[model samples]
Target chain A: MILAPQALLSAQQQIQRDLHSCLDYFDLPHPLKDAVHHAVMLGGKRVRPALVYASAQLDGDVMSAAARRAAVAVELIHCYSLTHDDLPCMDNDELRRGQPTCHVAYGEATALLAGDILQSMAFEVLGSRMFDTADLPNPAIALRQMQLLATASSKMVCGQVLDLQAEGQSIDQSHLENIHRNKTGALIQAAIMLGATTVLPVAHPSFTHLRIFGQSLGLAFQVQDDILDITADTEVLGKTAGKDIQVQKSTYPALLGLDAAQVYAQQLHDQALEALQQVTGNTQPLQDVTQFLLHRQS
Target chain B: MILAPQALLSAQQQIQRDLHSCLDYFDLPHPLKDAVHHAVMLGGKRVRPALVYASAQLDGDVMSAAARRAAVAVELIHCYSLTHDDLPCMDNDELRRGQPTCHVAYGEATALLAGDILQSMAFEVLGSRMFDTADLPNPAIALRQMQLLATASSKMVCGQVLDLQAEGQSIDQSHLENIHRNKTGALIQAAIMLGATTVLPVAHPSFTHLRIFGQSLGLAFQVQDDILDITADTEVLGKTAGKDIQVQKSTYPALLGLDAAQVYAQQLHDQALEALQQVTGNTQPLQDVTQFLLHRQS
Candidate 1:
């Protein structure tokens, strides 16, 4: 059963609310806090956290506080990465999520600190009692989940470093895949796993299915993002279009052409849906999420 | 009882070995792996990790694996921060711990990635089985400990930001103190707390005492470092002396005068020893660590 459009939008809104509240707790110095607060306020799809909430729900822990906190954790990490990635030292874009990039609104140093604070705060929020009541196994399970998030964040950073290294290089598809897999795929997969892991103690057997769903969804999300980089309007995307070309970044569209990229995204989306089969819950939201990831306009 | 000199040296050497072995499992990029190997070879007193080992031993979790891994985690975080602290975007120091700093030896990009890898590896080491063997609470406790480390690391980054911001400014004592506390003191305190937190459960009563000890030790270390900036010879310190003055960044020595700075360090050292009073067990190593933090020649 596919989730109704209204229902999916509502879920996305709820995740965004929680994400906004969680980000509000961070207090950095001066205009940097304002810059970060504004950056988050501009708001992306909240897709990563939504997937977390959606997948955890499928595993029987749907909308639990633990799931929400983990969702928020993954999203904060993602936002932090975006802020840093857009800095002059890296991709150097002046806009993001449809607003001035962090460094453009704030100085480079403050922007750097803001991202660092958000990254650390994400772990703090997840480890706190906000989700402590989520019927998850003792603190150990929560700790393991947080550890996984950190691993994902680290991989993302490594990917950023590699991406920075790859600029202007005539890289092949494999290298490009490695970069995105580490950069985007790691966090996306972590977001899904973070949601699913909350149901682990009670639904231990379903992890493999959730992992498959997460892995496929993560790759599909990246492919769509690559497509957006080439196809979306700057006003609609809220960031500079043709950034892939400007930075000379190798993307699926760049390597495989836009049409082939679409086919690849569809295949990954189908794999994501097939992975949802092992679970016996309402798979509607999961279906919608897969479709939204692959087919969304911006 | 004060630990015999040989005993302290032996413990430090052992920690170096364990930390080296921890990195052995990671198949990192060449320059990164090579830079870290070079960093570990820098024969600075492993003061922070020693404090960890000493405090855990003082807390009577003697023969505990938690003590050792916690030691490794703290030191790795220390090394990671140092590697980045020396980056051109930050301190831009060309030398550290006697040899060329990470950025100087391996281009700035690799140095940054190396710092990142080391940071991730610190959490990984903490979450590994070696730290879990002593019936440590749950992954929650370990995760919380890691979170605490992250918080400190973030604070250190903030401090670095503050220090960088203060460059060329007419900073007073309070501002200097804030900079040192955030940049240097936070991690020092973390070293002590990481050691204690590992042995006791997350909610243990002793954490506060260990925190005080860490705070005092951290301040003492920073003041002593400031004192060294003026008093220690370049050859002895293995870095340029009076670089702080050269940069015009305010420091304890700059604010308090040389004699006053020495007195301030003594006060902090005593406070650290006093803070250790709440813990039961052998007190010698902890005392030595405090002394080492304050009065080490190099």
Candidate 2:
């Protein structure tokens, strides 16, 4: 059920082009411009953008400019978060994507500004006239997309706050869920919702079904990540491995025991697929994505 | 011609109320909620919100709910910038508005998250349907307003980056102006533009006039701030005084002599007033506000 590697590569390339085009809007100074370019082109797996594309495909419509912009915007937010989270005051990470982190290459101040500018650029892309048609889609849809991105971003930061607060403390299951659901799950759900919203009305039943599917898949995605942190090697992971355990951060395997954690991931993956079954289209891409999340090695 | 104290007070109260109401939308945890509240409620001059109100009034219409929301959004962004700028890795300031900085009150991690959430809330305030009217204004205008905010924010951050880089370096007058224009001028201009967009079309000639006015006033405002850092005392400024010099940072007065800087501020203030001459309606409030900026202390 794995997706064709070519499909993922094409999506990444499309997103990369859209992201690069964002820089053309601003005549940024040379150093800031270079850092912004480096931040976006760090070459991580374009999973969020891929989700946007796969979700858009669910309605049998070709990817429109709106969908492409949303994909790029979500990816920009993801990249911004990674850049900031790796700052010296925060995670203090040195390596990202098998390369030196943004602050390590550009000074801390430039890296901070780069993250801030990247975040602003995300909204600019969503709000601006990125489309080529004479008649644009409903403006309310664009506003709603911005709202979704902002809300998810707020939740993601709040989750990070909670994670930082719980660093040395012994947290329970509900606490762990709160952290992951906000930290990682909110934006994942936002990616799917943003994509679905491009073609589906906010009140559509398909929207609800997709929300549930995204929620389950997002949680599954994080659980699998937690599993990989302990089981995967650094060379395969492409970043530091076992970071969670090293930092004494709680993870699914630590909280639920390794055997039960695997079982839980499988259960969430099945639930995600079940939610997609209610939709009346070819959901094979979504199914393949869910399967991919469940089995991704890095 | 100074703005009536009561008028400024009323606008400040209105903006404060709208900002507080934003918290009602989210049931945050106690600590984070308190920090966010503290960040917003650390009352300052509310000059940005006043500019928003004054600009909206230039069209001879009562302020709409949209205008109120835009005013609050600008203020929230301003607050978020101050919160982040005071972080240990950034300015590392210990006081603001005569208060212990957010990072000082809460931990650095919490303060960082608080700033991030406050920024998200700004967009939420702008994009959400907070109005009582069933018929909303054109969605394109709202999108344009958001774009202005995001662009201004990016420029402001870039300015901060430049400022950080320029510290301890002997910079020229043009470089100093560049830092202030992006760091402080962009958002101030954005506030005026946000208010004007609520009442004026994007293509309206008035928008151009207001942009010039805002740019002039924003730069003048920063020059005055630099002058006050040397001329004013800590108790009157309500923040640390002379910290710019203490940090060995470049300022307008440092690049240009203090007397020439004062003359430059007066010139910019005159330019701001001249831009208002082309505006159609009774621009009394704007005129009074600009006069206040040119002459006020503390």
Candidate 3:
């Protein structure tokens, strides 16, 4: 059966339902809840969550309760990061995904608290009930997943710190790679790992192969993001385009030239596909995800 | 026989060592690591960590790796809350524990990220290895603890939201109670519950009684804090004194007369001890801690 790149739209809708159900379970103060909803429900591409189930090799339309928890967990972390990053003190963006940013819609303080609580909610979901299949769900899986999420979350923050410190400075390619690898790459790898964890033990050889696939794909995705920032207009991008250059951020185009960066992106894409080839199980979803990421416009 | 209030001094030292060791385990970027260390290490009274061990009813000097995790987790959350609460947009306090606030010591962005990362670190610590004694460590215990902590942490943020909204408004005692219950009482209850989880199951009778003890003590502690803010100087308080009144916040002393607030504090203290009486374990440490909380001048 040919799966023409697992339907990201389907995964997006399913994740929205999962996220809505999770939010409905809690009754927060009105403003806080509204802010959280605005921040989360305004919605992005749901690429990370889609990657989660894809890496798990689940059918595009099927749901694993365990994988749902992980998908929600990563999405929450991603949403919260965006909210806080949009704060006046951080990236200071006024819009995200074609809507007023969280801080702009809700005041900065509300947005900050909303972001902070979303993070706690992520762990709450993850540490709760696991896959129903594990008659007695293993604690180690949750522990290992929590550890991975925390580490990635930490690295992501570290990357931001590096980004903030490196602003306005011309840095080399190596430093630039280090920054993206953590800033965006860490969480991307984490999403893939969490999904893989749903089916594989921590020591499985497939994990080794999966990690390489995640690493290469993550960089390739960032490289595409860089390319789009220069190529796409704000209307198409749903955010202010050319932001990387505006902020004087060191990007692939800036360091390696647009031509070399495009070539590098293709190289990374090929590398990612090669790594996935080593993994067993229905690797089709991941393969589709990799191909989709390499060619996505926004 | 008597534990001298379970020697909060000792717990503070051990938790400090534990936190320092945790920090040393990671080689974070220089500025971020420094910010985290400053936020975690510039030491508060360690009241929450002390409560963790006190509720566990362990010998003052003895260490349980299990209880230690709970202790560290709550402390990390408390520290991060303080760091965020002290932000210019929030409380705007420059001094904490008689030193510069995190935002003041580090830049606002770095301080924000530090507080943010400290939260992830808390779950990282909690969801990792469990008690050394559990032949096969149970995931339920960690899940329960994480849920309690997350819930309490969420409530605390809500309380802050309410408090922010209540600024410049004349609120009733019950409203103030609602605010304090979420902000301070929830976490206090969580600490007691987490410590109890170390030695007791979820449905243990002692947990019910211990919760009441925690509720009353939490209120009493906040009531005492209100009294201290009104009566103490900045030097003694280590934070801005009389600032609550300056900000027109509704406090116990603000709603009730100072003399009446003191009377109410004593009544709450008595109520706390009354609840502790129903517990069957080594109640001495808890009793001592409650008494210490009642009389503590700072």
Return the top candidate by lDDT. Answer: 3
TM-score of chain B of each: 0.91, 0.95, 0.94
2 against 3, candidate with superior DockQ: 2
Residue B15 in candidate 2, Cα distance off native in Å: 1.2
For model 2, what is the error of residue A202's alpha carbon versus the real structure, in angstroms, after optimal superposition?
Answer: 3.6
**Candidate 2, superposed: residue stretches over 4 Å from native:** A1-4, A131-138, B1-4, B131-138
lDDT of 2 by residue, B185-210 (tens): 99999998898888877688888898
lDDT of 1 by residue, B181-207 (tens): 888999888877777665666666667
Best by DockQ: 2
lDDT score, residue B278, model 3? 90
What are the C-alpha RMSDs, in order, of all predicted structures? 3.5, 2.3, 3.1
Q: What is the C-alpha lDDT of each candidate?
A: 0.74, 0.84, 0.84
DockQ of predictions, in order shown: 0.45, 0.65, 0.64
Give per-residue CA lDDT, model 3, range B40-78, as digits (tens): 998777888888988887334355676888888899899
In model 3, what are the clashing residue pairs, if there are any? none
Model 1 chain B scores worst on lDDT over the 10 consecutive residues at B131-140
The alpha-carbon lDDT assigned to residue A148 of candidate 3 equals: 77
lDDT of 1: 0.74
Binned by DockQ into CAPRI classes (incorrect, acceptable, medium, high), candidate 1 is acceptable
lDDT of 3 by residue, A64-177 (tens): 677888899999999999999999899899979999999899898899899889898888777666334454335677666777788888888988999888889999988988
Whole-structure CA lDDT of model 2:
0.84
